[model samples]
Target: MKLYISLLLAAICCNWALAQSDPLTVATFNIRYDNPNDDPHTWDNRKDVVANLILFHEFDIFGIQEGLSHQVNDLDVRLPDHDFVGVGRDDGAEEGEYTAIFYNRTKFKVQESDTFWLAPETDHPNKGWDAALPRICTWAKITSVNAGQTFYVFNTHFDHRGVEARNQSARLILEKIEEINTESLPVILTGDFNVGQETEAYQLLRTAPGMKDTFDAAEIVYANNGTTNSFDITTSTERIIDHIFVSEKINVQKYGILTDTYHSRFPSDHFPVMAVVNW
Candidate 1:
């Protein structure tokens, strides 16, 4: 009986060690753009709130959608411990909204980074495929400072008004991932996809080979509702458009849709989706 107990204890220890090894906390937040019409919930009112949430959660790396250049600057000032990479979608040079990736500078080292428009002319900025507005994706090849592990992170905000644009953008991203990741490193994709899970565009990404939704793959989950709240606590939380997908090589230990609010108001219209993963 003592031997049996010892073997059980060893097994538990092994499993715990494996789960904790090189764990990374990643999140995707669609912080509503700094729109003045969203009064009472404008960026000025919620900038610190958003920064506080990121700090409190201790996110190692996170992607933000719908943040303008000034908003990014605000976060940069607030989160001095971290650094971000990405450019505005309008001109690729800080003119429009940014799909930015923020990382803890001391925890990870960026090996390479760039942004590309989600269009046939990926090399330059242009509206693509019946899109209402131009859209872009920002990606980075990052290495973990502590573990010396490298992976790719791609972040984007899909065009909300264009159905065809969303579909084409999804395909374009898949192709780009294949092209850019020559090392075949593990990939982490996060974004405000702007479409529900039932949509074809979402399904295309969800069914992509070597990719898995972290939410579905996690061993522990804390999602009680959908991601978008639209600043109204009474809003229906049935549609989850924001997402995070990872290469199959990574193991997602836990996933959550953080619905944290400040003084009964949301920091953003969309709730941030967070995952704890390890390779």
Candidate 2:
């Protein structure tokens, strides 16, 4: 009887441990455009700083926005253990800007990956938006290594000043997400939306079928008050421009905006928003 009781206790402990370890962490960051305004002041200039910051977060999946080909290549070199999927935002071929998804090679398998331009002219890889420049969204179907569960991940960077572009982009993303949801797979969308929760774009995204902001799903989530002014560090004003939105099928364990204090060195102007979820 004693041996049987001990075995039962061990089995219970193992089950609890498995439940606790099933959560996956994901992040969305708009690594500021590599440009002159950034202090270590240069595009792709502070590669080490950016790489280190991302490594410190230890996210299982990352959705990065506004990265050029060189910048993405640099990160790939820096993070040898991760695999990335993305194409130039301008064309399906790898030649322009990108919204990329980086997943830990050991943690997830990329089943399918593709990019879509945020405009009515979907035939063209990147054209039709009234914004100053074109915008793109990258998506991937990923399978978790530990649980063997699969889900969809999407990332994008909306136009900064074009109101119509932002609204239309939201609509486009929603349509794509709905198409993918037919399989009933959980979905995660992350990026620099360039709009606040009160804006129409934000409202459109939240109301989309089966989607919910991770931060809103968990009432205890930390506010991203410092993330908006991430580029202009000199100012104290806050904006919640970056976000991680998850489909209702997934459970949001916790979510937070990674602040400057968490890093030994700052990587980009925008702080990364991370979410822990049970898939």
Candidate 3:
């Protein structure tokens, strides 16, 4: 009986130590889709740079926008230790751009996952609220193997051309978050929102109950530049559209816009926004 008690205590302590050791590194990147018009910035040339950035930064999990099926497959192949959860936005299959969330398979287990359209008829794939294109939010309930803790992650890209679509999309995501997270677990939201901090849509998300933007909440910040470079490595705009937001329970430690470049060239049109958060 004494040996059993001692073993039980040791197991509890080990789990506690694992849970306390590290904060999760999360990022949101809009890896500009494969376009021949992009020329020097096409996926073939930029994929390696993007992969290197993620690997070097050691992002435990990240959300990517504007990645098509082939692009997603490229990342999946490049990051052999990681897997993603999402679907194409056009037909709920591999037919269009994806707002996919990728997690380190060695460190995390996906417990639940789904993709929902940001439309009035969310059950199907269709343009919503006068949007020029259909948009989607891909989410997952993931469990950290190291910490044995579970959290929810929501990743998305809002309609870039519609004012009403963006606003309503924000509301729809918030509703979905609340509806799905009945346990009120820690939530991390990442995306390329395509709107600056001053916009109403940005305000809606920032002001939402229990949600705090990591850029604003982090104790340390670096490379605090605008997220969009439009493939211009030298331009440093002050407006930031990419964002990472987390629940109040999560402690945001550091935030940054990863302005990594390769031979003076940007890997993508938008720089990734990253954060370190702990619960």
Counted clashes in each candidate structure? 0, 0, 0
Whole-model lDDT per candidate: 0.94, 0.81, 0.94
Worst ten in a row by lDDT for model 3: 14-23
The digit string of per-residue lDDT tens for model 3 on 84-120 reads 9999998899999999999999999999999999999
TM-score of 3: 0.94
Tens digits of per-residue lDDT for model 1, 1-279: 999999999999987676449789999999899999999999999999999999999999999999999999999999989999999999899899999999999999999999999888997889999899999999999998766789999999999999999999999999999999999999999999999999999998989999999978999999998999879987767788999999999999999999998888999989999999998
Q: Pick the candidate with the highest TM-score.
A: 3
Clashing pairs in 1: none
- Score every model by TM-score: 0.93, 0.88, 0.94
Which digits, one per residue and each the tens of the lDDT, describe model 2 over residues 1-279? 999999999999997678556978899977766777665535555677778778887888999888888889888999988989998876676777789999999988999988888889754675546676788888999997776788899999888878989999999899988876579788999999999888999989987878999888864587646565554445654568788898887788788887663234456767889888884
Q: How does model 2 score by TM-score?
A: 0.88
Candidate 2 global CA lDDT score = 0.81
Deviation (Å) of 116 in candidate 1: 0.6
